[model samples]
Target chain A: MKRERVTLRFSPDAYDKAITYHLVRDYGLVVNILRAEITPGQQGNLLLDLEGEPADITAALSYLSSEGIKVTPSERQIVIDKDSCVDCGACTAVCFSQALLIRAPEWDLAFDPDRCIACGLCLSACPVRAIHSKFSDPIEEAPPADEA
Target chain B: MATKTIAEINEKIRRGEAVVLTADQAAAMAKEQGVKAVAQQVDVVTTGTFGPMCSSGAFLNFGHSDPPIKMSRVHLNDVPAYAGIAAVDAYLGATELSDGRPEYGGAHVLEELLRGKAVRLRATAYGTDCYPRSQIESDIRLADINEAFLFNPRNAYQNYGAAVNSSSRTLRTYMGTLLPKFGNVNYSTSGCLSPLLNDPYLRTIGIGTKLFLGGAQGYVAWNGTQHNPSRPRNEHGIPVGGAATLSLIGDLKAMSPDFFRAAYFDGYGASLFLGVGIPIPVLDEDLARCVAVTDHDIQTTLFDYGVAERNRPSLGTYSYGELKSGQILLNGKKIRTAPLSSQKKALVIAKQLKGWIEQGDFLLSEAVAPLPQQATLHALNSKDEVK
Candidate 1:
């Protein structure tokens, strides 16, 4: 089994499409919506945690691409500027996922990207403005080259 | 009883024979060998704390321009500074916000200056006869300024309370974010390693005492504003809540960016994270006992920040040991606790101060005047009519 975190962006036209329904029914993938900001007529995005067989997950992503939904890897979504962070542990208070923590003995701040659900809570909790989101807005990727 | 004077300690330091220990090490040694034994062997106990201090600011004397302007209004990097002092002198407060930038403020400007970055300086004057210029604009770096010194009204709080929320909604405060229904507790103190906590009653730390400030030697100028010594104390004579702050001054030109930086809270405004260390000479067995205080002995009240009032409801008092353990039992619930102050940086600073004293590079100073012990705080009365 394979597990991957990804962001699925939907354009206004794709809002009516059943993206998660297709992933679970056709691709046999477990789709967990970590966060979502979808309105009926407006463009929105969903942060999802997908778990399934390697081939099934790949096929589900391909299906999403064909349906005009943009899929972005969640690896680079959250960035912590280590140089500016003082490791005061202020961000750990609001991080429910335990993604941000202060290591014991040394009291150094540690960030585990895998544990983060990208809830965007740590962005404001940081006192030095160190935590930031790279792709906060939905990026509209150019439509796949029309192949007749 | 083993007793020594600050002069004797300084002589030992000069001869490279003074025994110095960081507050944490001294506390452990005291636990092993007892306070009397440690008091006889140790000459100095160094303590440190790195935390956000909102009452910190810097005074800069910019050299006069070609045509001198009596700067009535001054802005540095778009952040307003108090320029009512002289022709080119201004005081930049840490909490002063930029015109539109909420995250950037005077603290950021000071940090950038320490990093050797140039800041834009713009000033306007009413055009005096002696100083004819009406307005001036220029770029100024730390090296270009005549003098830059830090004058903090309050720093190195002796003790502080932990904050928790009892209401249904989360509270965003200077104590960091407190979750609803006491989800988490937030505290800001260096515990046993804090300077004021080690000295407790201001026995060794007072006016004219030379100590480490932002990596530079600074002096305790006065009793800090809101220096309430009348706060209730535990059996060890330590305050149960926030008490006994210090007003400090130092040469900002000689400081390091590592020990000084700007901080912005989620909803709270800008503040400076200052690293301060104070050396407590083992002048007597009494002073030795104070420095030997450990996290297990130090206690503080946990107040509910959910109540939006000056006097919040106190939940209970807990030791720093329990707080540092990552979780504490509050009302039979295991609540996770977090610290706003950096214990790692505080330890590093304490070790650095110990190194300086052991190498005979830094000498202790006897306080010219001791801080008042009977000071009490009073709240402003809005209903009182002005005379």
Candidate 2:
């Protein structure tokens, strides 16, 4: 099984449609809605974590694009600029996922990309403005609906 | 067991026969063997604290150049350092903010030096008869300096208070970012592993005492600035609020970058994370019992940040043991509590200090004088009044 964090930009017309419901029924993907900002008849955003077989995840991404919804990989990550980062571990306090941690004996900041649920809590916890939101990662293949 | 002298402990250390234990180790030993038995055999208890100290800085001698400029002004990587001292000597204060940018400060400059990075050095002076160069803009690294020593005015706080927000709005405090509307609580201080907490009365941890400072050999230069030993205490002799601190001196060249980092609080400015370790000699059953005090016995009142006053009303007091359970009850709500201080680093320091003593390299010192217990701290006048 594979997991990916993706953000869906829903158009006013698509907002009224049961988008997540179809993904689960059609592709057999486990969709965990982390955050939802969209309302019916309004262009807005929806953040979700989708888990399923690699083939199913690829097909789910393809289906969303077919329904006129813009699909993009969130792939959110917490980046600590070493020069600015103080390793104060403020983020570790509110980090329920334990993705951001202080390595023992050295007390250096360590971020595990795999463990992050992209809650975006550490962005505010850092005192020095050291933590940055990064979308750059090895995003899994989510081909456009026409190709896959 | 009779009270042992510092001389006896040093002699044992010199002979590689000293019985030493880290604060965490000592706590466990006291529980298993009892404070009496442990005190009889142990020669020293190594304690440590890793926290953000704003009063930390270093004085550096950059060594004169071909045309020596009696540096009346100095800038390291665009961040200014106080240059009024001498030709090349300057003091970099931790809280000094960089030009315009509040986030980058003296701590960041020190970190750059620690990492052996070249800094943009700019200085100006009135041309003297002997030393005639007026201005200089050069790149300098820590390797080019003659001497660099960190003489921190304060470090190793005995104990600190826990912070939580009672108001509905979030508070960006000098303490780590407090979540909005009592969403979470944050606290600093190493709790049981803290240096002064283990010593309680400042019995053996004193001036000239050896310490593991920023992963290097250091010493207590003096009682730390704001050495308030008169804070009210509980039955266990632990200060309920802010208490004693220590001034430490160490070679900045030997300091580790890993332990020392430049920090910026959201509302408050830049400060350095100072790692300090002090070894306590188990002189008698009394001293041992002090070290044995667990987190359950060490309690402090959690203050609401909403008041924005020094006298923030206490939500209630909770023991370190209870706080460390990872959740604290606040206003009938079980709010999650997290420690800003790295207990993981504190434990590392304890183990390192123990290793130094067991190797017969570190020596414990007798206090020339205990930190003042009777000195009353002066409160600032809320309103100006005249007779």
Question: Could you say which candidate leads in TM-score?
Answer: 1
Q: What i-RMS does each candidate reach, in Å? A: 1.1, 3.6
Off by over 4 Å in 2: A1-32, A36-46, A51-58, A62-76, A79-89, A96-117, A127-132, A135-148, B100-102, B126-131, B381-387
* lDDT minimum window of 10 residues, candidate 1 chain A: A139-148
What pairs collide in candidate 2? B45-B280
lDDT of 2 by residue, B201-286 (tens): 88777777778898899888888888889988999899987788889899999999867877777778888887888888888899
Tens-place lDDT digits, model 2, residues A1-148? 9988887776665677788898899989999987666454556677788999999999888788887667766644556787766555788766777787663345577787666766677776686567776432222443444553
Estimate candidate 1's RMSD in Å: 2.5
Model 1 CA deviation exceeding 4 Å by range: A11-16, A39-43, A65-73, A135-148, B384-387
lDDT of 1 by residue, B1-387 (tens): 888988899999999999999999999999999999778999999999999999999999999887788999999999999998878899999989899876888999999999999999999999988999999999999999999999999999988999999999977788888889888999999999999989888888889999999999999999999999899999999999899999999999999998999988767788999999999998888988999999989999999999998889999999999998888998789998888999999999999999999999999998899999888888775777574
